[model samples]
Target: MQIVGQTTQLEAWVASRTRKFHINEILIIEDRDHRHPKAEVIETRTFNRYIPLASEQSNLVDTSVLEGLRSVGFDIEDEEIHLGKLRLIEELPTPIRVGAPARVPSFAEVEDLLIKRKPHEGLTLGVIQGSREIAKDMPESLQNVALLFDKENGVGEQGGVPFVFDYRSMDQYPHIGIFGGSGSGKSFGLRVLLEELMLKQVPAVVFDPHFELTFDQEFPNLPEDFRHSFKKRFVTLDAGEDIGIEFSELIADDIVSLLRASSGSITDAMETAIKALHKKSDSFLTYSTRMANLAEALDNEKEIREQSRDEYLNPNDRERVKLLNDLLVKYKDKVGGFSGTLRSVLRRLTRLEMEGVFTSAGTKKVEEAFAKRQLVVIRGSMYFLNVFAFYVVRKLYRKRRDYRDSIQKGRPVEEKFPPFVIITDEAHNFAPKGDVPAPAKGVLKEIAQEGRKYGVFLVFATQRPALLDDTITAQLSTKLVFRTVRSVDIAVIKEETDITAEEAARLPYLSSGTAFLSSAITGRTTAVRIRVSKTTSPHFKNPFEELEEGFAEQDEKVWEAVLPSLPIDASNLNAYLTEIGRKVGRLLSFDELEKTLEDFVDQGRLLKVSTPFGARYNKA
Candidate 1:
């Protein structure tokens, strides 16, 4: 250790004999009072005094004088100095006077600072970036306590340190935000995190619009020992397969929001009609049946009231009259004019019903997953995702909140509804900052504000941070920011995170799989390379590769299915297509079959000719 330069409480400049000091390297400065203040090297520079001196004093200094100085052991040309600029990790208890001795910390001291948390204190996310000495000294307990990812320590020739995080701290901090541009490893990092959660048996619901989170697929290239049994813990609720929510569970507001998302805005009359209908009926089927019956009753009553002459009433006629009168009175109080508004509301509801969203059967209750600690993946379109996410999030969040409240009050709580985390990949769609609120925005906002107290957390991942709701963004306790090219997004990240100007500048240039993690749990902003995922999405394949392998097989099947249907003689295109449709058990439109024939003609597989009966096609 040597005192070479100036020192202060927060920063210092140190001169060293060797240029081995690395960026992000930690150093200890000992004051005269023996108080050791830790500092991290932020910048490094090499100094050569001879170059400046030779440039400025060329006329004053002669070559003979330089040679004489060199002979007398005053050779400035042979001298090189290493200078490091360091930022203090914490304020010194006592201000260090100038010229304090700065020295590299021993492995044990660095280990204590980087690892060795109290038992059950925190989960290891990964080792500190760029520090190999600290990486090798990480405690063995950290390996099993946290999900570990291998990262290159800038100092070493081999082996990586494990980066760690205290997942339990999320209970206090609440939510996490993952922001990155396309191909920035945002999705990949999310998979890694989810896998960790799975290993820990934390229940999660993932809203996957892209249908990518099929955890059944084994992690490619992973050792058997490292692979996880996701099939037992993962459940996929596929929208295309008609998995949906129970219509009886949806209120009028949910219907209105679903309508607005699927179609457009709803008028006041439409809203009133929906609410009235919902009030009258117990379920979707009941609502539809009652509305149809009410419309018929009103029509019959109007016809009878407008009759030119009164007819003698029989017993059946009297009962019919009484029923019509009763129906009119019941609906008139609920729906003022049930003609136009009811028709419009029913039409929209019927359309939603036909879309297979409001179903009694095949409803996947999210509470089931919470009870079992399984990862429930709801895969669907944006519209379905919006509506379903709203319902599930609202229901689960309230249940968890109520359960916690019940426990606090010494009341009976449901054991099935436990603490859970909700994850959304395209989170901006759910909690946007725009004027048109997403269907899930309100519930998501509520959870973001108060979910922490109830053991509910949100992991919102999006490419655009600026578009996310400010309340949700502000509530996020941890942010894993990947490479973002948009200046607006970068500005938002810089404002929200504790990253230095240097780190902010590096955001655009950060390599894929690398991110800047800022969290209250870590108490500092760190740049980390997210680990490789053991499990991958089912659709993780190159389109070109898939097409290359599939095209020939598909072409052969199409030819085999079509050739037998073709006539030996010239036949009209429609006739040939009809025959092929019968053989295939599905009919192709005239335009579709015509296009296929035209392609075959171009490929010399068919011959087309103009005849009196219009175009005629034959096998070539």
Candidate 2:
């Protein structure tokens, strides 16, 4: 027989049953009378301390028992109750100031008797009928009770063990959210989750600003053919990678906005540029060759080969031109309808999705697998100025939506995208407030509102719940609240959560990694400690240090050489001419200017800060 620890049992029971089950106190009463130490005094509370008495317990003070007194109503004084080891306890007589000596008892007397006899030991058992209440013998370590949706063996009536949901269940809703603070192991957790998604045959598009989750080095030892094929799918966008652009597929608006440019105009420019670049690259074969050549050139020369050895010069435009020239050479054959090509490419790139595909080789013996299984690790360490995490989340949302729209409809319910779960690490950013056009906000809200029907679930992780939107904040069915130091966030969580007032005050003092999981899925809330992830072997970390230590020197060198040549004088006519010339050059597509200005106005920037007053020049 397995002798389970009382604390572990208690925790499991409470967490399994109630969304608010938590341990208040556990006193070990060295029950040396028995060979082992026994838990004598255990104090526990439900999510909402509204404890209901059992029918057996309530019968002790039933109306019939109270009205059967011999004497009429008499005001009673201090009273006591005595109980024998065998029979139940009876109430002691209460002395009256006057006549009858209170021969008969009132309801109060009977109630007091019942309270005293209410089994402090054997007879006192807290039976959890369903997943709501805790049995008296229930131990004290359970946490995170939830109404799980099983996709495999199916859900049972009650108290039965849960079965694992099949992988196809995740495709129903591919969006996921995860939140955590500094050193919270959020990245490690995400990596593991991604691995699970991939193994299940789900395709993924990841934006890794930190670069911790990208590259062959991060995910080692897989099938070389499969790994290489997957690698080709990655389209990195940063200053580092050769073919990589700085634009984001998730929030095209956000990325362009960061450039302090107009979203509409920038998006148009991006679309145009991508198509033009692709078309300008010769043929399919030539395009592939040139792309390879550009990648090689960037990797080999490290810097655009210097045009002059004697004269000091900046190499910015030289590198850009070289890269453009290389791209042209590659896509030279497919250059005609470049704009259309670009639009299609952009659309294809943003179709981030997780789906099950048939993997067994032969046509007859085909097996199912998940699509969108690639692991994306953006170079996040680039700069906090670039919201890489936000960028990735937005992209992920778009992918999920696209996948939902695709597929042959009216098929068997199970055959379609099965239920998928999304877990975001920095949940606060995904669900923020106050009139910001953040892509994550809309996607999170959409999932929160409609995900359940689609089997798309979300897990939000955040150190500060207060920063989250109230609607999204209020809808959390399950919550894992860790140790918090702020009063406001704690109070907000308490007010927002279903836990009792007593539990709120205790939230801020929990030990590190110890948290309370509360939700309607569980009958009560429970407090528990989570095991931390291992970080000794190959680990993922934001590449901030590398850029600072390794890349910064190189970036600075490149910047220095380039700064001297461009027009910089604020008052110089040439500066004005250059600025106007650049603006006019943009007239190659005048629509870009109008659209950008409009977008700026919509975002409150154009209005808040008037356009710089300058002498206007009209091009002849």
Candidate 3:
């Protein structure tokens, strides 16, 4: 190949004898002085002199005309010339030489530009596109690294340079954002990322709203050596079952936030009532009792005012009246309007209590997994996770930040907590845009902005970038963008990352298991096909496939029991029924047995033989 167009400092065109060129392939521009600048092929074109742009009398050339041209040795295939438009990865002082020879470079030539860490040192996500030429010279560790997957063809053998991400760079760059639309590889790529974190034993907390992050089952078709068991390295916790809020640990603001999450909104009056009624170390019962008493006092205002003069009041009722009087006198100025405002708070509190958000054991299991440097997967519904994530993330982040802050200021170390990464899918629901308030948005936004100082990071994956909070989206330095078709999301991605217009145009057409890793850590945008994971989600089977398999299994059990006594007619139905029922473990009646036998015959699993007495059933 040779440079054939006007060469500029930023771009040059190279012509190849071959008919096609791979976009994003690296080529070295070898000049007389051997400056050896590298450039990436961003676009390609191929044409032939034998075939004109269009036939004279038609919009396109007919096949018969092509056959005639091939008969004379003027075939279009022979004259095809492939051209690649290459953009320099690093700019030069002057334009590249007009006739510089362009060839593929060795791994050593592009290793620094392409990779920041080794497989074990970083996250080996997948193979970079168009790196096969350098694969031969790659070290053993980088060769045949990841098994790429295609939805239509299944798995393909590993080749090309593996894209190992420098996750440690999060200390400087901070958070990661994963963007894509539905049916994109957004969730699949996330699963691979979490697997790498477990492989490295990095402490992480994952909020699984879909409950598909369980890693106990090994992925089918993975090679034996590549197989990994994550049962011990990761723990899945159900919100309000395995982990929840310790109600006594919550303050006034915590209560307000939980109520907002549970009911979607909290009025100013309700907030004021919560602050006045909820005391320190107040459990769910304590808080709920205060709310109930205030509402009762509002309902019986005349009775409360006249309780001191009542004649037939019992001692129990008299003492309760005094306590209500004391509460009303204490918070008369801090809050107002008891029944409507306090009753709203009571309803929210009661809903959360019934959901077990305040009753179940708190985040002890999550913290224990973090201390052991294991991945903790928190599973719950969208609303449940929203309610729990705020408390969990805020509490954990404080521990890590306080530890780091104490070390920085030379203060006495109180309690030790390790730094960890937080990951969540469908992240837009947790941190949405506009004026709406989400439960986890506050702490998540804080972590996104300043968590790097404390070694706390975030990995938020969502199908809609447009709906995510702007502040959090801006803080994500690394973006793994999968197939996104929505124009609104595409516009946001273009403005947020270093992706170009060409790449943005291709977003709607990208297939599953493919993504663009546009990262500040790499300082570039890379087209990547994700690798096959070592573990699969427990619910990987399609619902339709499961339905078919269930029927087939039931039919097999029935066939096994019927095979031994297949030649049964109406006369022997009673005699054969008992034996067949014993084998099948269910009582079979004459009509039920005969109908099933005829259905099997209709399905071609059995045949009916004509006899002197009647038709007899037999295996096909």
- Which is the winner by lDDT between candidate 1 and candidate 3? 3
RMSD for all candidates, in order, please: 9.0, 24.6, 4.6
Q: Which has the greatest lDDT?
A: 3
The lDDT for every candidate, in the order shown, is 0.72, 0.37, 0.84
* Best-first order by lDDT: 3, 1, 2
Task: Write candidate 2's Cα lDDT for 281-377 as tens digits.
Answer: 1333443344445444434442435432314445775555566555445554444423344443333333211010111121111012213333333
Candidate 1 lDDT, 1-620, residue by residue in tens? 33343455666665555555676677788765746777777766554575676424464344443443344344345566555767777766555555566776765676555553442454334445556555455556444332233334321222234556677888888899999999898997888778777777789999999889877787555545446677778788876354665777778888888777766677887777677767522688787776776666666767645331346677676666665566677776677755666777778878878877777643345667667888888889988788677877887787788888888999976474778889999899999996866888998999899888898899999999999999999999899999999999999999888877767887898877778888887777776666656676877777898996786565455566678766423444556666677665677677766676677889899888777766666689
Clashes of 1: 12
Cα deviation of 444 in candidate 3 (Å)? 0.4
Which lDDT value does model 2 have at 70?
12
Better of 1 and 2 by lDDT: 1
lDDT of 3 by residue, 1-620 (tens): 77764667887777766636787888898975537888888777765765566223233543443443344344355566566878888778888886677899999999998889999899989988888877779888786668877657676787789999999888888889988888787888999999999999999999999889999888777777778899999998999889989899888988888888788788898899899888899888887898888788777777787995677889998888887777677765577856878888888788888888985477789889988989999999999999999999998998898899899999999778898999989999989998787878989999998999999999999999999999999999999999999999999999999887878988999888789999989988999889998888877888899999997786677788998776677567889888888888888888888888888989998898988998888789
- For the record, the alpha-carbon RMSD of candidate 3 to the native fold, in angstroms, is 4.6
Model 2: lDDT to the true structure:
0.37
